[model samples]
Target: MFAGDSDLSLTSIDLFCGAGGLTLGLENAGFLSVMGLDTNRDAMATYRKAFPDAEAVEGSIAGYDFGQWRGVDLVAGGPPCQPFSNGGKRLAAKDNRDMIPEFARAVNTIMPRAFIMENVAGLLAPRNREYMAEILSLFSDRYTILPPRLINAADYGVPQKRMRIVLIGLLKGSIDFPAPTHLPGRYVTSGSVLRRGETQGYSNPSKIVYARRPDLRPSPYAGQLFNGGGRAINLDLPAPTILASAGGNKTHFIDELHAVIPYHKHLWDGGKPRSGELEGGRRITILESAMLQTFPTEMEFAGSRSSQYTQIGNAVPPRLAEVIGASVARALN
Candidate 1:
């Protein structure tokens, strides 16, 4: 893992901040976040529960003062991943995807020194590319553009191999790809990391390796954080990304390994062992999923078992937030 950028003292405002992944990454980087805005009630509840000190506003950002956000050093979020994913029905600027543009309006109003936008790699799809282009194009008229970089949580030490596009907007300079803190784990087959060292790609699009969209799910990631190559971060990496499915819900069905184990149901009921997994072809439990997302060890839920799961899944990985915060701090210093 990367040496923590501990001295950066920037602050941030998170938008469309479902579960707070961007918020968490920025916090990890050393930025002090003042607020997070999202429409989902449970998602906000979970964010507030974990980050009691920060203001987790539950609502659309459309009616707020984009101008009042000026003092912050950064504005960040992943928005909704589903609207642009190939696995789901693709929706670009038309399918409620216009929120991306709305997000831009927020950034324009607040005007941080730097802003970051992240979404599923499918956002890079030919048609959706224009929407991304439009957002950046409008911003570029006044700010330095970082273009857009695609990265995976796995490459950065998180066990799951989720890949997304990150757009960095600077007030006066450019943004390069963040340095690699970790590489692919040995256990996660080469197919998952990059097409067998092909690095770039050949004429046949599928033959292309590194450029291919990253697929989530690391091979057999049920155990603790162990990057055989010796990375320093935990299983969820610096901080885990919150899932849209997270927060106050864990109606899971476990695999026979967890189901037929003949062990007490209480143990796996809400522990860290089950995340993104299906037991007996059913969803995993609540508690385990939260731990996988790396919620603070002290965090607790006041509602039912599923309520607890919902909160965890909806929270921003505190670790990732720190990373973003650190970068902002660097610029401020």
Candidate 2:
């Protein structure tokens, strides 16, 4: 499948490829993932199990060799948003959060045609923006920076509402992030997914339920992310960024309706069932979380429950990754 358009059929190396969400997207975008590197051995296990052919190196990202790790299409799985996120503490650029420079240092050494860095919205906070600008400026000689965009996962087909910042860089020509396909309203509809024991998927338009017929329509998600007159959007475009702790972190959510899905009766244990107290719940299962990130069904997480959560949470949603990879692949021409 990846045999055609060799220049555009780019080879990829994913750094910090936790459970391969970004790699999954690049694979979908028709790139050959030659290798992946990550710190967590467990995430490496998950990544290797699903992609046995791809080489997955497990260890700290600091020492990864840029020369040995060269690829025509470069990508970063994540740079660890911990220092930037306000959830724990806002370290911004100083709190051991300055690894992106090292990441860029390696990128400069390898010098791929294009690359992308995904991060928390907090990276744009005044404290960190200067450093981010510095990194952008450093890359200016080689890459035409695509204006950083704050994208919501719901803007695409994702069932969740999560915001993320993406910086896309190209060697010469400017890269334009794709325009949002679905706008508010304009045929975007919200509906409820039935539990395993429930009757079926339905669009109670009065209740905003989309009905699934046994003969025709197939049910997607069984649980609903809406209540109190809010709803999930079925977008025609690619989904917003699938967050690392997307379902777990409620503070990142915009709509009250979306923030509640993780705790609610999702397709967990095959969709048997959440309480009202689940409002600020712990999190949803790793499987449900990965699904929201657009990983393929054939791939399974190979780790403990929490490891699975950590792996899925720390990933760049594959759907968004596809856009990034395809953009680079096109640029290679």
Candidate 3:
């Protein structure tokens, strides 16, 4: 396992480990990742590249053996959450992709001292209260289940307003939720991200063509923030949630001039929104998305563009994960 000066002896195994975001954060905060598991070959490949010392395995969680991870210090993951995503069919536990039961089983088998599972806030919607109760009951007896807290990435120094429900359970005792490290109005803003100018593939021909298209009209398919109807990103503040499916019209950048910019622009702010001028509404690049998730700017992503975006968007922000990890470290020590 990757060891550090902190000499943290605790080890962890990550289930559904997409691109190693949680693993990276936990490692930064002292827990070494012994293994990372996921079914997505490309994402697992990227995880391997990022964490050369850790084992990255590909398989369905239900069929995988938890025996190898038994006696580990912690088990951490964010299971496939499409069933609980607001953008998806809210099937809750009925969605075959729902992996909470499998996760619960793994935790039971591994019998780790603690575990942290993250998912969309929609999982706790009133309609899914019973499902939430059932899942919590699985750990309540042997573990002190901390209240599932809604954690916003922006509150932890990430550049986006993404919110995920974090459930931390300890074998014995309780964990205090990490306090918000950043307050409103002090967040990293979209405008700042735009100014960086270092994102890969930012100048692709196709993207430039789409971004400069002056004839595109607003449609329902567009994200509300980009459709010129709902709220646009407050560029001076943190961005709205960056989506896994962001493309074309789904999300747009609004500039200081009150003009709607698509993700296909040549210049970052679409060049002052002038009529008959080359316009800007280019999509946020993969690197920018990763930044919003607070991945180190120098971190390497080894996947296709779409796969990279999926991994970045689906990840638990490393900033937030570090906070959780530090808390876990304190509680464990």
Candidate 4:
């Protein structure tokens, strides 16, 4: 499919391509993925199983040669977000895990006709404004850097309200981002996709029940960060951002409802009424997280349950990626 360097048909590679989410979207948008790279073995295993044709490289991006990718039409991937994640330490450039420098090096060395970088919106928050400016300056001389846009996955038909920042750079011209395909009130909900049971060709996911600790108080952020409702999911609305955390603070959905009790009932009742305390509330299964992230049901993912959850949480929702991919593809044309 990627027979030429022509804008309409382009060859691409994905760096930090955990579980192939970004590559999948780019593939759907007509860019042929030449290869994919990541350091995590389990994630690479999942990527290889999913896209056997795309050569998978398992290693760090640092010290890697980019010369082989010289003719690549596009380079796309998000650097790790832990350094700037609000749920994280917010270390910015100080964190040893910050990969933005390597990302810039790849784009600079590959000199692709176009590129797309995605990250948590926290990178653009006021605290990291200087770092954001530094990242943009890296391409100021060559690529026509489009304004960094904070995009909502729900706006593009994903079933969750994930707010991500995207930066698109082109060698010659600019491209407008894809407009929202759905309205706010009409956005898809978590229940709409999660209510169904296991289907053919998909893994059957068991529900996880939340256990309350008497010593701890209910997390006020039981729902999505932007929404302040208790942990029980408002099944009628889009899900909160799927977190990468493996902790007690992660968002949970209410699987079953109990008789209405005081807001702090769970706090004193030793975690009773906690999210997942009843039949309906619990931590989301890996499959459920994938669905919320807009991955296809039939697509197979490999890894332990927790490992798979990490992979899914870190992925760019394919629906959102598809939208961005199409926009990038249009600019190439």
Candidate 5:
């Protein structure tokens, strides 16, 4: 397990702080999270439950006072990424959900020794390049911002192939991104964290819909196997990104008999199951999703089932965050 220097305890304030994923990771790295801020009531409840000692404040980041948090060693968050998410409208800067500017505002006001901003990889697309440049310009004068890097959660042992863009800014010194602990051939697989036959309470699709589009064909690596947004998961490999839209029919499905059925082949003898026929696969449960996201087994999420799924899906993957936090702690120490 990665451990930070126990002698030097750093501090941080999580801005978006959904369910305390980043906060949990940083705490594991020996940083004390003093406060967490967010707007979702359910997320705040989860965050509070996870970090009871830390103040969990519910409110929008916009117009919120960050000056009070001045001198915090680090200010970190994954701002709302709906604007740049591939699953969303891809509105870029035009979307009302865009919160990069608010994140920059918090960093500038807090003037922390360093700041880490996480967002979807789509932010780097050519269409959003100019908007991203504008967002970075907000911090150029105050901090030494590193070139944004796209990081894969699987590289850090998270059992999901989640990719995100991370931007680190330092006030004085340089810090390198954490090196991948697990390589391609040895990546931690879904089977490492997820258990078999744990689908008791979770719902499965009524009828399985196979992808007819050639472009959606399942590949050796990843692809859409079903018609819904859910992707097929290979037990021996990292699962595809667990989306925020889970807890519904769109949630990714797993087939214990994948080796037998394989790819797009039907479970029945000749064709797709009739309408209302129970699909022979199971969608992952809330606890299973949290486990796949690398949350502690004891971690309890508050709020509705949908909200819990969203919190888990939107989290930074505590394992990945811990790796990043360790790097940051090393730089600070």
Candidate 6:
């Protein structure tokens, strides 16, 4: 936790708050989360449950009034990123789902002492650069916008290699981005949080579509044996980015033996699974996914299995958020 004067305390409001990941982190960092806002029913339910003292409002951010929260010490959120996501159409401001402008509008209206916004790295893609410039202009009159930084959750001790762009703006104070707490070879690994023996009631992949075993590559990031967006996990290293599209064949696979099987052409000489060949593996469970995202073990997600996965995948790792929140709190103090 970032220490401040004896009476230093700050209040925050989280917009686009899905399942309260940022709220949880800020709370852990000594900020009082006064309110949360989101459109997903299940996500709002989870947020309300997690932070019962805070008011969790359910609605779209477009045209939402921030008049009542005019003096919140911090305003933070991850607006819908589908429009600027690499996997999406990249419509940017043209896409109806693009909520960056709304986020800016909220910041300008509330005029918080400081604000933090996180989104997919694709937001800085060449195609969306112009649109991003326009959004930054919205805060020029009131806040000093810091250079956006591409941050990896693993650098902050999250067990996944998820990366996102983080932007910070301050109305009248100076703040720096949080420094990495862990280095490359010292990263926390997925194996440290997951175990093969703990897969009792968790779901498994409908089918194992191994194109082939891992090749004799020199890099620790080499083994990608699955067919969909998912890949084979290197237990010794951080897991690949967890996707919101979980509970399907695209979900990441784990080698039960904890060994990366060597490439064997005969295993699938024709690019299809052999009739008599088999391997020991299973898709990661929702709980495991949450663990990888660095969510608290006892935090209950209120939704269907798929909705729960979406909540976990979409969350900013609470650990990473706490680091950022500490920095913001120090600036405020």
* Winning model by lDDT: 6
Error of 6 at 119 (Å): 0.4
RMSD of 1: 13.2
Per-residue lDDT of 1-333 in model 4, one digit per residue for the tens?
Answer: 333646456788999999988998898888888899999999999999888988899999999999878878889999999999887899999999998899889999889989899999999999999989998987647898888998888999888888999998998787787789888999988778766333223332334443443223454334222112224455677877777653233535444443223434545454444454234344456667788888887767777766777788889988888888888888887
| lDDT per residue (tens digit) for residues 1-333 in model 2 | 222436545777787788888888888877888888887888898889877888888887786667865545665556778888857487656668557776687678777777788877787777877777776876637677787788765565444445788888777666568666445553222222112222221111122222222111122222333332122323332223334443333211222244423423243334333223323212233454566566665667876655665677677777677776776667665
Evaluation by lDDT, superior candidate among 1 and 2: 2
Ranking by TM-score: 6, 5, 4, 3, 2, 1
Pairs of residues clashing in candidate 4? 210-276, 254-280, 255-280, 255-281, 256-280, 276-281, 276-282
Decoy 5 TM-score against native: 0.90
lDDT, candidates in the order shown: 0.54, 0.59, 0.74, 0.76, 0.81, 0.82
lDDT of 1 at 289: 47
Candidate 6: how many backbone clashes?
Answer: 0
Off by over 4 Å in 5: 1-8, 200-223, 259-279
Candidate 4 vs. true structure, TM-score: 0.84
Question: Once superposed on the true structure, which residue ranges of model 3 sit more than 4 Å away at CA?
Answer: 1-7, 196-201, 204-232, 251-258, 261-278
Residues 65-101, model 3: lDDT tens digits: 7886777878899998899888899998889999999
* lDDT, candidate 5, 222-294, per-residue tens: 4544556665577889988988888776677766555324433543334443333225566777887898999
Tell me each candidate's RMSD, in Å, in order: 13.2, 10.3, 5.8, 4.6, 4.0, 3.7
lDDT of 1 by residue, 186-285 (tens): 3222223222223221111111011112222232223222211111112222223334343222122223233323222323353333333222322333
Clashing pairs in 6: none
Error of 5 at 269 (Å): 15
